[model samples]
Target: MTVHNYKLTVTWSGNRGTGTSGYRDYERSHVISADGKPSIPGSSDPAFRGDATRWNPEELLLASASACHKLWYLHLCADAGIVVTAYEDHAQGTMNGDRFERIVLRPRVTIAAGDRALAMRLHHQAHAQCYIAKSVNFPIDCEPSIE
Candidate 1:
């Protein structure tokens, strides 16, 4: 078995002036960076006093799951001789307090020519193989429509 390791740095950048002296004293902002990659601006949910302009952990988690599934699905489609033209996913996550209850991925796909039934089936296969979906404890459901 082969294992891959990933690493990144998260530096807090929200010390307003006095630091975390009070609950609302500091901003919930940070930078996420890895070697040879662009840095990501991160913050908490806007409801939690975070900057809505920056990315939040919940959104990032949902993006990761969606991206992983998309990558796997595309690879499977390619190997199966299905020609995919366009793909877009509208993914959503439900969080009850601090824990995520579930994530739903709504992918709209446009194919030049392919088996519609097989393309739909590939979503289940993609979800089963997605690393992020496998790692997460919550359910990740894929609702895919092919055109």
Candidate 2:
């Protein structure tokens, strides 16, 4: 097996003039950047006094899982001779207390040419093979609609 290493820098941009002198003094904002990649504006959830316009960790986590599964599913579909025309996912994650309990991936797939049953089955295979799904402790469920 081969192991891969990844690195990124997160610079806190939440320092208000007071600089954490009080609980509500600072903002919950930051910048996430990596070499050759565009920086991502990040902030805590709105409930935690974060900017609603910025990306939050919880949302990013869901996106990561959804993206990983989409990539893997496409690859598997190609190898299996299932032709997929388009795909989009509206994935959601549920948090229990301080941790995530589960995530559901709702993928709408458009198939130009392929066996619908085989295409649906590939979702299960894709979930099983997704690295993010394997890494996370929570359960990831896929509900795919094939067209």
Candidate 3:
């Protein structure tokens, strides 16, 4: 078996002079960074008093799943001689209170040339091999369309 380790730093930057003095005293803002990579501004969901402009944890989770599946799908397509010209996913995640209920990944793919049926089937393989999707407890659904 092979093992891969990842590390990153998350620093809170929401102290408004007085530290966590009260529930709404501090901003729900922070920075996520790793070596040789650009920092990502992070915050809680806007409903939880987070900055609407920054990337929230919920959104990041959804993005991770989408990106992981996309990478896997692209690799599978390449190996199968499927020429993908464009790919986009409009993914959505539903949260019940504090827990995520499910995530729906709607991927629209444009292929220059390939077997349409095989292209669609690759989504299943991609989802099965997605590390993020496998790690998450909630269900991840893939709704793929080939063009």
Best by lDDT: 3
List model 2 lDDT by residue over 86-143, tens digit each: 9999999999889999999999999888899999999999999999999988899999
Worst 10 residues of 1 by lDDT: 110-119
The runs of at least 3 residues in candidate 1 whose Cα sits more than 4 Å from the true structure, single-residue gaps closed, are: none
lDDT of 3 by residue, 26-99 (tens): 99999999999999999999999999999999999999999999999999999999999999999999999899
Q: Candidate order by TM-score, highest to lowest?
A: 3, 1, 2
Residue-wise lDDT of candidate 1 within 22-94, one digit each (tens)? 9999999999999999999999999999999999999999999999999999999998889999999999999
Work out candidate 3's RMSD over C-alphas: 0.6
What lDDT score goes with residue 10 in model 1?
100
The per-residue C-alpha lDDT of model 2 at residue 126 equals 97
Rate residue 76 of model 2 by lDDT.
Answer: 95
TM-score of model 1 relative to the true fold?
Answer: 0.97
| Alpha carbon deviation, residue 18, candidate 2 (Å) | 2.1
Q: Give candidate 2 regions above 4 Å deviation.
A: none
